[model samples]
Target chain A: MKLIMNLMASILLSVPAFIASVHAETAVIVSLDNKNTYTSIDKELVARIFLAKVTKFPDGTTAKPVNLKQGHYLREGFNRDFLSKTESQLSRYWSRLRFSGKASLPKEVNTVEEMKLAVANDQSLIGYIDAMDVDDTIKVVHKY
Target chain B: MRIGSIIGSVLAAVLVTTTVQANSGDLNIYGFMSVGVGILDKNEVTIEDFEGEGNFKQDTVLGIQVSKQVNDNTTATGQLVSRGSSDFKTEAAWAFISYQTSTDLTARMGRLRIPFFYYSEFLEVGYAYNWVRLPSDVYNIPFSSFDGVDFTQRFSIGSLDNSIQVNYGRLNDELTIFDENYQSDLKNMAGISLTSTYGDWGFRIAGQRTEMTLDTEVDEAYVSAVQVATIAQMTHSANPTPQSGVDLQAAASALAEAEVVFVEQRRIDQGQTGAILLAQQMNLDLEVQDEFAFDGHVADFYNAAITFDNGNYSFIGEVTAIEYESGLLVDNRAWLASFAKRWGDTTTHLTYSTSRDVLNSGDSGKLQEALNLQGEDKSVTLGLRYDYDVNTALKVEAQYHDEIMNRGVEGDYAMLYSFAVDVIF
Candidate 1:
């Protein structure tokens, strides 16, 4: 009975950790060259850049934002966690801005590999990918 | 037909160009289509004659946008919209080029929407907003777009995000007023707007001003009456008669005869017997000279709005005022309050709006009375929106309009029900 109770307690404690691992981890990334220039970024700045509200980096360089194609898990996770918006909400927001001729939506890539490649090649480009996909070529500015 | 063909050619060109340029740079094509069926409980709300039945053209609209990023710093965009209210006439909604001047500033020049209200940018895109239609009380501006240049600056203070926009523009268009087509021109149109967001709360304030001129043809009857009144007053002042009342009666009879002949001639020329009957029934007293002209008129519009959203629930309140230093238009004030709650894929909302005219009592005679009769309008709307897919929504709404006052006449209460499908691609 004592052994069974300890097993149940351990299983209950591990449930959240297990669930967390099952959900894909996502991170905001930039070119490795920007790693030194922008060591870290706050959530507001990231949100603004992704939303096309802020077009420049903290160091006053033009920022090119990239987005993942719709229905991508990593993109959805990043939008929900960092921007506090759903895909539908973001689509509506962009529609208003785009139709008004005020702003344009970010460029979208099909896969995480393409995202990483694009970000790695362009110093101004900012994008996001799975946390596990982060490599030395691209820097992770934020993790979610 | 001309507008439609122009839009079609533009769309074809955009499609071909986007396809050809897809591999080189960023070229995006997006569109939204909305169709609604509305039925009024009574014939009180008449729009160009048809009333009291189901109508499909009241809220149907389609808009397509094409954007090309010339480079990292510049973009060109064009949008075409076909509106049912305008009989499915396609027009260029916006055509502009935007340049990112700095990290925080963007400048755009071309034909752009006049940011008159919070929803001005997306007024025709039903999917972007929860309401089947934005409150008509505050959104009833005569014009929606202008050829302009605008600059937007974005900044932040602590936790708050802020954007300020300044615009200069001009508008020249022809519109129908009181059953007569008039050429309207607004020059030196200038506007400024500020928006701020903190956490779940948002605030906005905007103001605009323009110098206007309107040229319209006045009713012959009105012109005759004014002339007769002037001549009669002059004759009485110049030469007093023992039978002055008799002379005045004879002048009034002549004026009435002239009015009758004018109405008869109009009926023959226009073949609008129903309009003539309605005008007579409503006792319309037109108050202008033969060639009605207004020049050097200044108009000012101001608005403020506040909103709060916490994912599942949201609330918005807005107030607007319009002041016109002109003889043809009355000052106006309007306000709206709305609340919505989202549950799962469905959201329900309720809104109440009201508007009133500010009459200029200084003017006497028929004009003052006409302005005074522009009484209050109020409405309550309940709506539901269901996101059926990633980029499509289905909505149903019911609106109740209280008794409305228009053109020296009072309208009865009206209830309108609508169902709409909104899709984005």
Candidate 2:
């Protein structure tokens, strides 16, 4: 009975830690060509860019923002941490802007691989992905 | 023949340009649709032709938008919407061409939304807002669109972001009041708005002014009174006798009696001359027309709003005031407060809204009654929204509306329940 009680306590303690590790660290990324022009970006600016409030990069070039498809875990993590908005909140925000003709929602890619490919192909493009997925083709501009 | 062929060639060229650009991935198509079923517990509250029992078509709508990038600096966009309130008639909601002058400035021209309220631009897009609908007391403006030019400028100061918009426009449309339609025109409509945001807080202030003209059916009593007054003046001018003065006073008193006679005569014979003779004897103005016209009227509106959001909790409050210089339109003040809490995929909100019209003792009885009817509505709404999918939400709401006044008299209250689905693609 003592051994079983001790085992149950350990399992219960590890459950929360395991769940916390399930949420991946998110990174805001740009094409390799934009690495020199945009080495690092502040969180505020990243939020604004993703929200379509700011449309241009620091170098004065038009910023094309891309996003992972809805329901993607990394995308939700990025929205929560960097944008400080939930998926539903962002959806409502984008709907308002999109319908009003004030701004357009970011283009969506189905997977991280597709997002990286899209960003790599366009110098002005910006997107976010799991930190583990960052490689040579894209530059990490911000991480959360 | 040459001119016709040249015009045809120009048309073909334009068509080709549109087709090629659309195929080049420079064009985007988007749309939203919302449908709802609502039931009023009692027939106490009425909106236009919708009242009594249950209604399925009152809140149904669909909108389609297309945008084309003409170049790096220019883009064209248009939206078409069909609403159940208009009997599912499709109309152009927006048709504008925007030019990006710089990173922080843009200019646009064409038919655009008149931003009288914070949600004016997306008012029809039900998926955008939290409520089942925006408070009708405040959002119920006669005109929603204008042909205009506008400039928008955006900037940031430290952690605060700001945007300013200025516009000038004109609108010519029909406005409906009490189930009667009037020809309405607004000229030289100009407005400015400023919005600021910092983290989870947002604030906005906007003001607008316009010169207005309206035409409506003349009241029978008013027409008769004016006719009698005119005839009295003519008789007095033609003959300066004491007997003529007495006759004029009698005619003025008989103006009310002449209404039945006028109606009877019109029914018997549409163009009988006997009625004119009777009206003339009563000192009526034979040249009176059937329509009442009001021109050179001025109207002004101002509004302010503040919002705060911290992911799990959100709150918004707004106030608006409208005034007419000529007293042709009722002056009104309205306010709304809303609070919401989000838990996972569900959000629950409560809202309170009220409106009152400022009545002037100096106004005519008829005008005062109309203004009173316009002034008094208060409502409390409870709503829940569930994100059923990535791009869809299911919402249910119940509103209790208390009518403070109806037709210059105290009125009763009502309750409404509604269920809706809002989707975007």
Candidate 3:
């Protein structure tokens, strides 16, 4: 009976660790190139680029910010990590832009893999995705 | 069409669109109303033309906005404004689609505010600002819009907040009064605004550029007179057109020719000091020759504000400066200082403010500070304000003007007093 109890206890301890590994998913800022590396961006320029109000980085390179499909986890993660606005307020801001005659809206993709693909292809692109989903095809600039 | 029919059409459309986007009962409705009177003392006025004693007035404004969420990431909003244009007219204040990328980064590709002045964002919603009207001296740029996009991002440092708003768009409009050209060129307009706020202090620096084709018509008389004189000169040089004076005749003819044209064209092109770019080799028609000139302007505006609360009183002061590289009519640099004292649970508050439109530009469009000795120009307004509620107020204002451009003009000083009651809902 003592040996059976020890085996059961050991199984329970390992079960939680297995579940943690199964559910763990990291979030990362996926950009088009090495320019947006975490160590490279100053806090000020990062805010500007993500906000859509800035098109150029501090180094004079143009920035093309993109986002995940609406209402996705990567989208929510982006808000929590970088942008602090709610999705609805952001919509209203876009409405304001439709008639303001400034710039075009950022491109969008439906999934993390799609966003990563787009970001990797263009040096000007900026987007976010599930960190675990990123592969050698894309660069992980900043993760949260 | 009747107002009722217009209402019916809108309601029907809303009902139809509601189904696809949760047309259920998520919609909300709101309205507003206001009325008031003006009591003024017209001191030393002539009763021959008209007369009035203590006037009573009424004003009405109404609007309804339909706002609802289509999903977690998008919302649709539309507003209909009525009787807001002085005349009985209905207009669309805003109608657009909005979608967000994230909480912090969002882009609006439809129509939106150009973010020109401090109060520009809330300019239409009177209740969003202090006073019955925005300080006209600073908030008076004409229509602001274009087929454009707007982007905003906000980040914080320690406890301080920093925000940047950028806009780019093309605009086409005609400016009727005192415009060198009818359009502000807005053809190519884009600007960036950077603002920082820490505690009660905030500062803003914004710059924008506009280019135009300089498609303006010249003063007909001025141009014609020049042409006729040139003709007379060549004729005189060739045939020596015999004048009443070998010397005096020539001078007399020149002066006479100028007088006839001046009398006919009383409204001279006032903005330009002399005949416009005619001598600059612009496109001029031999007979009413029309030429195109290239004129563009870049305006840079900056403002700073400080708000502080002491006990139960709130004090806010705003200072703004607008520098125009070339084209500016009036009210460039202005500063207003206001102090308010609250009483009775803030039901009644008394405030005093002094506003001045200082002369910072060479143009007289800001006539109150223009270098004109004689004219109905603007001046500094020192007024006492009393508010009975958040939406109503009584104000008595007095203005004092000084004439700095009078080399020998008669009246050098002017004073005006007015009392008005303003309300909003």
Candidate 4:
């Protein structure tokens, strides 16, 4: 009886955590040293910045957007949920923009650690991290 | 052409070497390739050379692009593209320098794609669109690029993002028209385009005007038409052929009688008169001269497009119209509407397109038919695109053209089928 009760309790506790893992939140981040007069940003502005439609922040400073390498889960989640674009669609958009000489693909990092480090060092760079992985070195402007 | 092929090979080799050597640098290299096979039910060659037998030479293409960031606000880009339809002859498609003037303004100068259609900028990149190819009816144009300078200004109005682009250019090159080579020059070319987007809906409209000159081939039909007109003018002198003299007299009398009847009919039909009647009287001439030559004539082009895409389903409607002040190339309008649905990794699309020659010469009956130099096309296409991976796509398309009219000859129907594999790296 005791073994069965313990097993049931553990399963009940892990179900929520499993769901949470599947639906992990993503945090759009900036560097801690940045003082661009932004405590939080809107999704539309984020989309525009990443798409290269707007090259500057509200403070009139150049905004350099960074991205994770292709096929990264965090990148995929950020693209779909935040940018509202699938991988194929995003790639197609970039292909059009790049070939037209209108825009270039954002710089890319290989891993989440690298992404965090890159953003923490460059005041102009904007990046994203998994919500749970957010640290003091980065400032989360928005989460989704 | 041979030199161009050598350069293309060198570029390809450089691309391969660079890919193997580096992934992090200021200099960036990009490439795209498509291999295709297509066949048509008719023996005649259509655009892209789809004929009776399956062939792989028409749709195969390879492109390489290299771009270097010259500064924080300036970039230099160069591109080379080779097409199998042109016997795999490579060409430098674009070489340009761009500067970001402001957060929402950019200026570029050098070789640039002619922004005549919605897909003009990225027309060679098959992986950018869902179709195996763009609809031919609306995208038909002889030239694709020009030496130009352009400025783009982007702004927002409420919730809508808008942009306006202005360009000035010139095109001087050798081109093939009607299977005959001609020295073509388009001078004083200028254009403006406006594009706007609101959520899932997108809109664009553009207009361009230019003065053009071309060395046209003198064919037998033109010679015969000139001879007939010359004979009609000299009917009072000795005639070479009695039958032609009598025929000309008969035609003249018939035209006079028809003109009288047309005046009465016009009075009854639209109640139009004065200048309209004079215009109608001018159409009684049996033959028009200089109708096929395009020497120092002004031409205009206009296009409008509306698009909607909400993730899984999309729709597009576009129309293009052209008018030449004087030429055998009559005014024409072409339009297309397409719908696509995506399920998982596959997308299916259906499109309907049509084009017709608009007679502005005021000619009627057989005269109008004789002067029609282009074919009228109405087609329906069904296509499927499968995402093999993030960097590759496989596509199959079938297009059925119905009741196509070339000059005065009408063809029943033609079916073309094609398959392509496109990859980008």
How far out, in Å, is residue B358 in model 2? 0.9
- lDDT of the candidates, in the order given: 0.77, 0.78, 0.50, 0.77
Clashing pairs in 2: B227-B284, B227-B285, B357-B375
Across B1-425, the per-residue lDDT of candidate 4 in tens digits comes to 99999999999999999886685487889988999898887876464346678888888889999999889789899989998877888877789998887567888899888788799888889998877777777776777788889899988765577889988989898765554456889887889999887777889999988877875433333234334544674773556478767767765665565456544432112111222232233545433334434667788999999999877899999999999775456678999999999887899999999988776644533344443455688889999999888888999999887757765477567788999999888
Error of 2 at B322 (Å): 0.4
Q: Is the docking of candidate 4 incorrect, acceptable, medium or high quality?
A: medium
Q: Write the per-residue lDDT of candidate 2 for residues A18-105, one digit (tens) a residue.
A: 7559766777888888843444478888887888777777776777789998888888788888788877778889888878778777
Model 1 per-residue lDDT tens digits across residues B1-425? 99999999999999999888766657778899999888888865753222679888878999998888898679888889998877888877789888986657889999888888899877899998898777887888777888889999998776688899999999888655544455788899999999988877889999999987765334556454646665776788788786765677778887777667656442112222222323343465433321113465788999999998766788999999998765456678999999999887888999999888777553222453433335568889999999897799999988888757765467667888889999999
Better model by DockQ: candidate 2 vs candidate 4:
4
Sorted by TM-score (best first), the order is: 1, 4, 2, 3
Can you list each candidate's DockQ?
Answer: 0.53, 0.50, 0.03, 0.53
TM-score, chain B only, every model? 0.81, 0.79, 0.64, 0.79
When candidate 1 is compared with the true two-chain complex, its DockQ is 0.53
TM-score for each predicted model, relative to the true structure: 0.83, 0.80, 0.52, 0.81
TM-score of candidate 2 on Cα atoms, chains taken together: 0.80
Flag regions of model 1 displaced more than 4 Å: A1-22, A35-39, B1-22, B47-50, B178-180, B217-254, B260-293, B364-367, B370-373
User: Residue B47 in model 2: shift from native, Å?
Assistant: 5.6
